[model samples]
Target: MAGGGVAGHGASAGETKLPPLTPGPYRRRLGFVALVATFGGLLFGYDTSVINGAGGFMARPDQLDLSPLGLGVAASALVYAAVIGAFTGGRISDAWGRKRTIAVLAVMFIIGVAVVSIAPSLAVVVVGRVVLGLAVGAAAVVVPVFLAELAPYEIRGSLAGRNEMMIVTGQLVAIIMNAIIGNVWGDQYPWVWRIMFALAAIPAILLLLGVSRMPESPRWLADKGRDDEALEILESMRPPGRAKPELDDIIHTREIEKQRVSEDIGKIFHNKNLVRIILVGCGIGFFQQTTGINSILYYGSDVLEEAGFGTGGALIANIAPAAISVITALIALQMMDRVSRRKTFLVGYALVAFSHVLIGTADVVLPDGGAAKPYVLLILIVFFVGSMQLFLNIATWVTLSEIFPQKIRAFGMGLAVAVLWMTNGFLTLFFPTIIAAIGISGSFFAFAALNVIAFFFFLKNVPETKGHTLEELEEHVTDGSIFHSIGRK
Candidate 1:
């Protein structure tokens, strides 16, 4: 039904082929946009963890002039903002379009970073951090959804995988920067952490430009009934020669759009099974945060020091978990496409739980001044981070993206992630209190218990979505089969 075709413009008379989707300039354009938006991941990592060095300056009640309560408020205000941002970001994206939503998020990142850089008071810093956190939450949820929808299901995991990889890479970069800066110039310049905070704008600006040029999701375009526009976007996705096939796929999906709800949120709520998926998503997300991963991320050095490491020892040891995370993640990226997501989640929970048990035993069994104890506990922590990256870190986000029907994909995923961030917020807010009340051993024992609970939940319920197409998944999951359980019919 395509109009401009003369039936002889390089395609056969009755080929029914999508004009050849020959490789072209469009993919590069998409990649550029995707990478730019990923800086949200960058800013997210840097804002949360880069403050490791800033804490001393921030804690100087005598010098910097702050109380413990003020510092705690400053640290946690961003999480609050993130919850608000995540809740509202999807509605804005639906109304304004993905590119515009991302552009606004970039502006927020820039403004927030700049604000944090100059804040002289705890109150001002809290305000800035909250602004930054809103940007983080929105970016965290939206970027992956945007990228996943744009990417062909063939490479969806690898493509969407980039965001998580970039996030960890950003954390690694921030940690390294903090270490180098804190070692050589942080004490002297003192405001170096501030500089780090403000520098996030560079990526923010880049993302603004990058996402602007890319096409909207063809599916999204089709959802709005812009068939011609959707086909045009789909045409650009493939080589111009393959447009017929590509457009047909898009058109086919569009024709079925009405069957899925225009109001996706309501549809998801009505489906009991989907509600379960959402709960699973929320459970995994919340458990992931409650595992105390953020505790180490936000205060690795402090945690290490409390284990009896010296001042400098804390900094060196702090990088260990981040390092462990990156290495395991590299290995994980290779495995993500190969294994079942359910199995991955189960394994992750098991390993983290075991590590906590080991750490708890070490704390209870090892004498206070025992020479071999800290090193043993450190190894256990490295193992814990490894387990987290291998299973929970990459897999949790991947599965959340998979479980929902196409109609409610955004609401389902966003709500789950919101729960994740909120749990993260509470944990970040109360980690110190927990540590004070229960002691290190007790804290770890609690995490181990949570992981045990997660293991059972995932074992009985988590579906495997490895290597399935979005269309295939939408059909398969509705049958009550989790991703891993779906047979290749």
Candidate 2:
């Protein structure tokens, strides 16, 4: 259960006693709202997997005619732009509101995807990707925070994690589409990659129409002194008796944040506690990309081709990792609260390290063009992706969303994810070069070494964020209490 000492646990002198929490139709309503918001996640996923197939098509002789370096440039443009979007989007979410920020991003997604689908030149393609990258970066920062603020602490992991689930689902959709299109029309059709890029516009449209009907983050309402409105939203989403107490907690935390002048990024450095928290947040974001997951997602076919499969065989085989991501991500949703964050991360990095070692060893030993090489490499990639989805991806986002105090939550999360996107951009830009220069054996081995470092990082820094309301967690962060334990569930 979520921790005690919640506000309104004992009525203040003049406060009326509230009734016990009860289930009602509003639970379904909240679920619906969550589903609508997660379309952004689907868009995120589609954007990821679409590149896997589309990048290959775009670089063909008759297409954009990109060089290896140019391919990296075009592929990483959005990611680089996303770094800008992530931080600015966080500030925008604070100034405007989470709901409005998402609405604006939805419009950007449509525009960005449309631009990419029709680009006749590499320059225009990079331009389109930059536009879409902004939306992706903003969504990465805002969506999980929106879900976290709205959900009850006990089930917050599952609700907030719906974004990641949708992300993998989007990846799944892209994989199926890529396999079908690559197999059927790849040779004959010149414009099939455009179709893949265009598909993202559908969900972007849905998000625009749907978010208008959804409620704002009640915590944001509370932070802004709109107590009645905040309480109304909380009442609708939370259990009856639980809403008032949670709102009280939000209000109380907001007061503490004000005392410390918490929203200022510079002030964060002055406070040792917040500095520590942000470091951990940035570390998780940094290490997530360093795992080389995007190398596989953006260039899976290329990885398989190197492993000794034909182009067609590689495209089909790439689906295996995508499928594993969805399945294990589902399993992750169940484990989010049941498993400790530190333990999940420790185990996840360990698995990733082992998988990389196995892959690198196999690649080194297998003869060139060996029949079994692709099959063995494919299995190792599956394990790598499955562990990532289960332990790192969903869990990292959830922790970032919840770790900071109410006043600086948006800014803090933005800074952390900006690091994530920036590192992701750097890796995506160089992955093909890395693979070419080092070969598969050396590339995977390098990542394996990085994961070994990541294991120690998780052990030393990450906090236990489960089973605590956002306010309670804030108290822990402010006082440096969370650093004391490993959440040894």
lDDT of each: 0.72, 0.86
In model 2, which runs have C-alpha deviations exceeding 4 angstroms?
1-4, 8-22, 487-489
lDDT of 1 by residue, 230-290 (tens): 7777666655655455545545544554565456466656666667777877887788886
Highest lDDT among the candidates is held by which one?
A: 2
Model 2 residue 83 CA deviation in Å = 0.6
Model 2 pairs whose backbones collide: none
| Residue 343 C-alpha lDDT in model 2 | 86
Top candidate on TM-score is 2
How well does each candidate superpose onto the true structure, as a TM-score? 0.89, 0.96
